[model samples]
Target: MATTNIWQKFKALIPEGSRTIVTITANNGNGTSQAQLRDGSVVTVKGESVQAGLKAFVQGGEIKGTALDLAQYEVEV
Candidate 1:
């Protein structure tokens, strides 16, 4: 799906300006992948993901744990 569509879906799952931690997993178009985001809560994107001004944010910088699949993520309050 397009980034906009994914972002819209994510927004519907969360509120605006809500403090949250997001984990993204980039799909390699393959079957095998890793899993993360043990928390079931949802989060919001804090910044843009691309130059097109996409409303997508990735989990990194300071947040430590494990890598997550870009396809699957969770928000933790």
Candidate 2:
């Protein structure tokens, strides 16, 4: 047996209505923004000197595999 993540489980068990939507709320010129999750969970977005961030919400068939590098700040800006 192999371990599977939520993405993979959803694909195998769910047949419909498994889609999720993402909305990006822009800053009010006050350097504030947020990414609203489907469940209404909010994760604050800090406006870096680059004034950039990434909101990647994935829900689908399979999450092949992933690599995360938080030290070098590569995933999100």
Candidate 3:
């Protein structure tokens, strides 16, 4: 006899919210601002008033807080 498992029926799950560091490009006003990712993608995130040309952490379409202005290094594998 063969046994069936229910867990195998589920596909690999991925988290909906992921945090990323971005630079504030512009302020949209009303407690929102536009940010640019490291790959040069611009996205609008909601959070406290932040000045443009600053780095901040964004998650779930919202800005969690500011991030350090450290140098970025990329590695190829």
Best by TM-score: 3
Tens digit of per-residue lDDT, candidate 2, span 7-31: 8877888665344333344433555
Instruction: Give lDDT tens digits, candidate 3, residues 1-77.
Output: 98877666553364457889999999887788989998898888898556798899888989888898998698999
Clashing pairs in model 1, backbone N/Cα/C closer than 3 A:
24-70, 25-69, 25-70, 41-75, 42-75, 43-75
Q: State which candidate, 1 or 2, has the greater lDDT.
A: 2
State the lDDT at 65 in candidate 1.
30
Candidates in order have lDDT scores of 0.35, 0.41, 0.83
Each prediction's TM-score against the native? 0.19, 0.26, 0.70
Which residue window of length 10 is worst by lDDT in model 1? 46-55
Candidate 1: segments with Cα more than 4 A from true spot: 1-21, 24-36, 50-77
Least accurate 10 contiguous residues by lDDT in model 3: 7-16
List the candidate 2 regions with Cα displacement exceeding 4 Å. Answer: 1-22, 48-77
Q: Count the backbone clashes (under 3 Å) in each candidate.
A: 6, 1, 0
Please identify which of the two predictions, 2 or 3, would achieve the higher TM-score against the true structure: 3
Cα displacement (angstroms), candidate 1, residue 27, comes to 16
Spell out the clash pairs found in candidate 3.
none
In model 3, which regions exceed 4 Å deviation?
Answer: 1-16
